[model samples]
Target: MGLSWQQGPLGAKAVGQFLTPEPFPERLLFVEPLRRRMRVRLDGQWVADSEDVVLLHEPGRYPVAYFPREDVTGLDEESRTTNHRDLGATAWFTVLEKKHAAWQHTDLPDHAKVLEGRVAFAWRAMDAFYEEDDRIVGHAADPYHRNDIRRTSRHLVVRDGTRTIANTKRPLVLYESGFAPRWYVPRADIDTAALKHVEGETFCPYKGLASYYDIGERKRAAWSYPQAWPEVAAISGWVSFEPDVVDVFLDGRKLVLEPGQGVVSHGIDRGLDPDELQERK
Candidate 1:
């Protein structure tokens, strides 16, 4: 049977959810070519070539990159079947995890040790593993100026023996639902003397730029992914600190990050809302 397209509430919702006309940021376009070269070899077969995959995301779903059947080379012909189709003339591949194994071996790649202490990839599926450079990007497309909804609140205050020392309210909040929400405290609220300056930086296509500082005795300090969305450039928020390197506290309580739980690192598990997040954001 062939695929079909029906329009109504379903189509309208799909369009609203995935068809925003926001300008394609230059960084996003640059990463596209790299994606095609990124692929995973499972059971001696390559699956999900980034060149022709449909990336999807939702509230509680890991990003899904549906690949074309032709892109997946290996797997028995009997089980390889067409599931659905999309606007880009791409067909989705439906394969069983049990039918593949070579990629599931614990020691399939020895060079993996290079990432031993630093990063971990969570593969919930058997024979499922993503190649080293498999970075998939998702674009947020909605009719409502999602960025201007005004969902975050920021504060800067000094902790003084159970009392707030100096405090200021800044209307900057870094709230991205699927990812952790970073509450950016104002620069004035922080005790720069207590913060040991460090040289650390990271990038995000959605967010502009970022810089880090170590707080008190914490190895890694408050980070500000400074350049924010266009309409909310004034928002400078504090994203979480380096795991194990520092203990983050909101409202006097400490923030904890478990192994393999980082959004950018292991790519599995996310932190639920802490009462601190609600108060600070």
Candidate 2:
């Protein structure tokens, strides 16, 4: 979560409130410059490349990068029309026979003129998006987003009813932007018998894919990112329990999920198909 998505200041459930007299809009949209060189590739062809890009941030949505029309190429005439609740009529464009692969808000009001001459390509429609040599996965990188892991000696414990499923003195605490710190336990500290592999999975843009496990009668009581992204590779194969599902303790104190702490499952961004994400680095 950064700036707009999830629990950021512009998100619907912001962790902190704006101390203003006037009520904020029910839905807020922010447009700002993306000062990095962004390039798009499709079918071994360069579709768009721009150093002067703009990013649109709306509540509950990943930031969308818009490139200046002059920097883009191979876009055909508008193939379809749609409406953005705040941005008005939007024109969808096809590139290299990829129908409706890009869009531009052609009928923007004066307030949103900053995006008048720009178009944004659908992330999943393109072959790959690059910020220099690094291929960005899941979604565009939120500049304000951060993920940090810290090793701690806190007495972390997980329980299913009266049985202690996991107990550890050394655990890794993952601190992410605008989210609660998650504690990951070592695999050796957990009782392997207590975990029953569950069907289905989820993905994190920052942490790669997650596999779930059901403990006893509880469904999806624990999860682990077996092949986490290199940035957060320390917790690979380590398990993190759902506090609201099973009892968790840290430093001899019960860890209860407080109000507003729970978040909607982050199942990748921009409706990316799970099959397109198997080779994440």
Candidate 3:
């Protein structure tokens, strides 16, 4: 869960409500400058490049970067036209013989006027999206999203009823924005025999691709990032168990899963990045 998606402020289950005289609308959209250079690649060509990109944060959706039309090139407009309830009539564009690889809104209301002359490219359709020299995956990086990792000597233990699943004295605590802190245990401290590898996999924009494990009958009860993003690489190859599905104790205190902390990660069809989460890995 990040700032604008999932249960964050601008998400469907927002933690706070807007203060206004009249009842606020059920949905809220926030637009802000990315303040970084962004570029879009299509079939080995850099199609869009700009330092003046604005990101749109919509409820239940990943934040999207909208680039100034003047900064985009190497793309031609298509005949397809569609209606956008918020932005107005939308026109599609073709990139490298790919139809509808990009789009722009024709007219917008005063509140959304900033998007009138801007365009957004389909993330999966492009070869890659770059911030400076490094590439970004999953979706545009959420400026408000944060990932903090710290090494701790906390006594953490996991169990499935009477069977001890994992015991660890050294753990890394991951404090991600808008979610509960996750405790990742080093492989040396875990019982590898307890984990059963499954067929599913997930990709996190900040973290790397995630592979799940089943503890006996508990499906996807445990997970690990074999190749995590370099920013928070301390937890790479470490294991983490779900508090709601397994018993987890930290510093002798039993842990409980916080409400709204349950994440429903869908397989790629959720419009997740196609290739991988780690740009260089």
User: Evaluated with lDDT, which candidate comes out highest?
Assistant: 2
Q: Is candidate 2 or candidate 3 better by lDDT?
A: 2
Kindly provide the TM-score of model 1 when superposed on the true structure, using C-alpha atoms: 0.38
User: Candidate 2: misplaced stretches above 4 Å?
Assistant: 259-280
Candidate 2 lDDT by residue in tens digits, 91-142: 9999888988999998998999999989999988888888977777767889
lDDT of candidate 1? Answer: 0.36
Candidate with maximal TM-score: 2
lDDT of each: 0.36, 0.87, 0.85
Give the true-structure RMSD of model 2: 2.7
Clashing pairs in 1: 183-238, 184-237, 184-238, 213-221, 214-221
Candidate 3: give its CA RMSD in angstroms. 3.0
The digit string of per-residue lDDT tens for model 1 on 1-281 reads 00001111122112123355883321110001124344544445555454543333322223333344455544332332232112111122224343322121122234222211111122333233443443222221211112322444344344433543234454344444233334455556655565555775544434444567766555554566554545446565543344345544555555455322243422221221223122222
Error of 2 at 83 (Å): 1.8
lDDT of 3 by residue, 109-212 (tens): 88899887899988878888889987777689998888999989889999999998889888899999878899999888888899999987886777777999
